[model samples]
Target: MDLVTFQNTILPIKDKLFRFALRIVGNPMEAEDVVQEVFIKMWNNRYNMAEIKNHEAWCMSVTRNLSIDKVRSKFRRETGIPEGTDWRDEGLSPHKSAELTDAVSRVRQLMETLPESQRRVMELRDIEEMSYQEIADLLELTMEQVKVYLHRARKTIRQQLIQSESYGLQ
Candidate 1:
């Protein structure tokens, strides 16, 4: 794609890519860095861009991989487990912002408990609002497989939340 075409097409995806990176790396600054790096890499490899049938999927894959690498590198230099490890244990109060934040935290925790494939499917689908075809292409799964995993992940989270509610945690 030409520079102007690429800018018009890809610039709109920056927020989504940043959010995806943030979800993976759990750090805003690092996520921004990853998005910038991915965009730079995309620009440098612009010649091969035509070979990519799905540019958004390609970008998401790049962002996810880079975020994972950053997380691993940071872990290697850390002395202990990161904060928010047990973030799911925190429940949402009825207050608006706290409730939303708690719900996000709970979902993140439940996501962490899932198999990597399921978690990724859930993140890309529910969190990032990606289409099934897009998610399938990004994760290299069949569309049906993506739907199945996403369904299962949602079911699991719903059950967990229901159980928590029954226990009067909220």
Candidate 2:
């Protein structure tokens, strides 16, 4: 595809891809590298892109694969720990901001505890707002599997959040 077409089609989804990569790789710098690599791959193979339907799904699939590959290559035995959360918000009181930050951090911790598949499914469905069919196509899982993982992930996070609230996890 031409630069204009590429810009119109591919550029819009870069943030989504970067977020997915960050969720998997857990480092902002590494995530940026992953997105750049994805862009390079896409640009290099632009001629063949037309043969693939659903560019977003295809890009997501590539981003997931690449992120996983990066994690595995760099840390075979280490699980990724998410970093670089922006804990700033305007207009909130300090107490409120700290409370919100703590809650978000707790949820991020809960997400980290999930099984990789469940976490990925949750991020794709909830964070990226992808459809079940699209997630299935990208992850090469059945629709049922994606739904089950997402359900389990959400349930686990919700239950954990409730339990933490009960215990006062601040």
Candidate 3:
């Protein structure tokens, strides 16, 4: 594609890519770096872009892989920063209610406790509002598999909420 086409099509997805990276890496700065790297990769591979189908899904898959790779590298090096930092608070500011903030934090914690596959699926399907076919394309899973994972992820989250309500976090 030409530069104009690339800008019009590719640049629009940067926010989505950043969000996906942030979801995986749990750090906004690192996610921004990942998105930059993804754009660089796309630019470098621009000549071959025409051969690929579903450019958005391809970009998302690349973002997912790059973000996971970054997380793995950080893990190997032992970054002391703990997970589950509330990255959302800065955006909410003083507008959103404290109860909503706490609930979001709790749900984020619950999401962290899930298996990686389930967490990724939940983030893509629910948080990103992606369709099953799009998710399957991005994750390289079958449509049925994507559905199953999303179902299980939601079920697990629901069960956890029920448990938390009934017994509290003893």
Model 1: per-residue lDDT, tens digit, 1-170? 78998799998999899888877787777788999999999999999899988888788899989999998999898954468554322332457545566667676677789887888899888777888998888778999999999999889988998998899864
lDDT of 3 by residue, 3-54 (tens): 8998999999999999999888888888999999998999899999989888
On the 0 to 100 scale, the lDDT of residue 51 in model 1 is 93
Report the number of clashing residue pairs per model. Answer: 0, 0, 0
lDDT for predicted candidate 2 compared with the true structure: 0.84
- The best candidate by TM-score is 3
Model 1 ranges with Cα > 4 A deviation: 79-82, 85-105
TM-score of each: 0.76, 0.82, 0.85
Error of 1 at 38 (Å): 0.9
TM-score order of candidates, best first? 3, 2, 1
State the C-alpha lDDT per candidate. 0.82, 0.84, 0.86
Highest lDDT against the true fold, candidate: 3
Evaluated at residue 151, the lDDT of candidate 2 is 93
Candidate 2 — which pairs collide? none
